[model samples]
Target chain A: DQQVKQNSPSLSVQEGRISILNCDYTNSMFDYFLWYKKYPAEGPTFLISISSIKDKNEDGRFTVFLNKSAKHLSLHIVPSQPGDSAVYFCAASARGAGKSTFGDGTTLTVKP
Target chain B: DTAVSQTPKYLVTQMGNDKSIKCEQNLGHDTMYWYKQDSKKFLKIMFSYNNKELIINETVPNRFSPKSPDKAHLNLHINSLELGDSAVYFCASSQPDRDGGYTFGSGTRLTVV
Candidate 1:
């Protein structure tokens, strides 16, 4: 069973525009959600995360919004740059689970 | 310096051959994990070790085993390799699964013909 899902296989955005990636989960027990970005041939790097207690968390130009009721979360990057072009993965974890489950990932191509 | 490192960035072998992949982390994490990403890009957890103790076993086949000689090194051994086993294996470490997102190695691409 896929606990976390990223419906979009790919997304394209022009430079300086906003890029948003979405993820949905079926596990209600998840209390923490995280976002990671991966470049070709490289392992994923942590981006931002949000706790179940908060509806939103922001770091620099990246923001993560969570809706516990809908079991959904999104990552937003404003003023997107070409350097941001890469695959983005959304992962979720629950307390006491001791491991996080990752979504398949979405390829984000930020055009220059 | 690479926080998490794995040996054999690329491995190609014949079916029924046995092989091992090694992993090491220098992030001072007590918990380590192995994840497999298949051709379809599905990431699945295979095993996890905390303080050199086995914690999570995801119902993998018996032919596959994970060993952790210490808190920082975890190795995966596979017997009778199969074509279906071809994929990219990644090693990751975290203070604890819940408190951290995990630091992953570049990955090892394994292919069986």
Candidate 2:
């Protein structure tokens, strides 16, 4: 069973526009959520994360919103750039579980 | 220096052959994990080790074995590989609490013909 799901397989957006990626989870025990960006032939890199206690967290141009009631989270990149094009993975982990469950990933392409 | 590194970035071997992927981390993390990214692009956790002791073993095949000689090193050995076993395997390290996300290796892509 896929505990975490990224329904969108791919997304495209124009440069300098807003890019939003969505993810949903079924396991209510997951208290921490993370986003990772991966490029071709490279491992995924940590992007942003939010705790279930908070509704939103922001870092520079990137922001993450968590709706605990809906079991959904989203990543928003304002004024997206071409360099932002990559596969974004949504991961969720229960506290003290020591392991995270990852989604299938959504490929985002920022067109210049 | 790379925090987490895996050897043999690409491997192509015939079916039924045994292969191993070596992983090492210089970050001094206490916990390490192995993840498999299959053709469908799903990253599944295969195993996890904490301080050279096994902590988590997912529903992976028995042919897949993980060995951790030390907290900084975790290796994966697959015996009698099958065609469906081809995938990109990633090794990652993190603190025992995992409050911060994991640091991942570049990944090793294995193709079994």
Among these predicted structures, which one has the highest lDDT? 2
Interface Cα RMSD per model, in Å? 1.1, 0.8
Q: Which tens-of-lDDT digit does each residue in A32-104 have in candidate 2?
A: 9999999999999999889998999999999999999999999999989999999999999998888999999
User: Could you list the chain B TM-scores for each candidate?
Assistant: 0.97, 0.98
Error of 1 at B107 (Å): 0.3
Minimum summed lDDT over a 10-residue window in model 1 chain A is located at A40-49
The docking category that best describes candidate 2 is high
Q: Per-residue alpha-carbon lDDT of model 1 for B9-102, expressed as tens digits?
A: 9999999999999999999999999999999797789999999999999989988999999999999999999999999999999987455588
Off by over 4 Å in 2: none
Model 1: per-residue lDDT, tens digit, A1-112?
9999999999999999999999999999999999989998888888988999999999999999999999999999998999999999999999988888999999999999
Would you list the clashing residue pairs of candidate 1?
Answer: none
- DockQ (C-alpha based) per candidate is 0.73, 0.83
In Å, residue A87's CA in model 2 sits off its true spot by 0.2
Worst 10 residues of 2 chain A by lDDT: A45-54
